[model samples]
Target: MEAWIRLSIFVAVLALMLVWEAKRPKRSGRVNRWHRWRSHLGLIVTSSVLMRLVVPLGLTGIALWASEHDWGAFNQFELPLWLAVMVSMIALDLVLYWQHRLFHRVPWLWRLHRVHHADPDFDVTTGVRFHPIEMILSLAIKAATILILGVPATAVLIFEIILNACSLFNHGNVQLPTKLEAGVRKVLITQELHRIHHSSVKRETNSNYGFSVVWWDWLFGSYTDQSRAGSDNVDIGLREFREEQRNTPFWTLLLLPFKDK
Candidate 1:
């Protein structure tokens, strides 16, 4: 039932974004959307299958198990349910923020993560493009965080939903009005900020690492307010992945981490 709810929401948000981008696309004419969507959708499907096979219990299950055994910090104390839920969600977000940073800072992990950055264009589909190995490792990290924090199952469900929704929202090719976007960026990561993260320039690529909230990037000093070439003109994707054939294929994306690029 929980899985169904998440899936339903995911489909709804993705469909909405698809239409939004179609009408108010931030940039276009770079690559064939059909080709890019094929690879992006393939990565998402492949990673989802691998996750089900490897972590069958999922993050919320881990939280429920911890609660049953009284095995984690929240369970060990007498905190209010609301307090526990709020803290757990914040902590989970913080952990993921660092996890994203580590993936970029570490050379080997970057190989897998670059599968995401290698998308020649950014859109709603690009939000779901992640290497299977990276998704598995992310699942492990999230599960461990849930266990240690004694996050309530409800909180885990909420956090996962918000996280997934934010990924699609921030990565949307549709942009907000400048004034509204400026205000939005003060809170959540807007598409403009995330777009800079996909810039081919190393400096821009390394900044704006937060996936949901903008606070982490600002607090950690990784924030880049604007792209060097301006938001619309910022060169997307890695320099090494300039050729469309090199980056936009299902098999190529799966084998990308092992390649010498």
Candidate 2:
């Protein structure tokens, strides 16, 4: 049932984002969407298979188990259910912000993390383009956090849905009204801010690490108002992988971390 709910929301939001990007793209490209989707979907499938084989129940299962065993921080409280859910969502996001920062700062980790940044374009599919190892590590980290925080299982479901949806939405190529982008970004991460993170420029790539929300970047001083080259002109993808084929092959991404540039 939980899996169904997550899957439903994931599909719904993905469809919505895809449609919005098609209708109101920030940048029109001649790139083949089907080809990019094939590669991106392949990567996602690999990671999903890995999770099913190893951690069949996923993070939500871990949260449920932890709750039953009375594990984590919020378990000690008899607070109202609504308060617990809201507080846990914020706390989890805070940890995720720092986790994202670690992925950039740690050299070995960046090797896996760069698979995401290597994408030559910024689009909705780019949102799901993570290396399998990164996804595995993320699962482990999230499980540990859930157990430690003793977050309610319901909150876990809500957070996962929101995180998934926001990732797709932010990574999308959809254009937004200038004033709305300004206001929405003060709370949620806007696509404009996310494209800057995908910039080929080293400094910009290191900034705007938050995929779920923008507050962490603003609070941590990693927030850059606009790309130095301007959003429209900024180059995307890693400088080292100038050859577009480097990012297209599933085998290349699978072995990217171990390969010599």
Candidate whose lDDT is highest? 1
TM-score of 1: 0.98
Score each candidate by Cα lDDT. 0.90, 0.86
Top-TM-score candidate index = 1
What tens-digit string does per-residue lDDT give for candidate 1 at 53-138?
88788777788899999978999999999999999999999999999999999999999999999888889998999999999999
Clash list (residue pairs), candidate 2: 73-149
Each model's TM-score?
A: 0.98, 0.96
Clashing pairs in 1: none
Off by over 4 Å in 1: 244-247
Model 2, runs deviating above 4 Å: 244-247
Candidate 1 has an lDDT of 0.90
lDDT of 1 at 145: 87
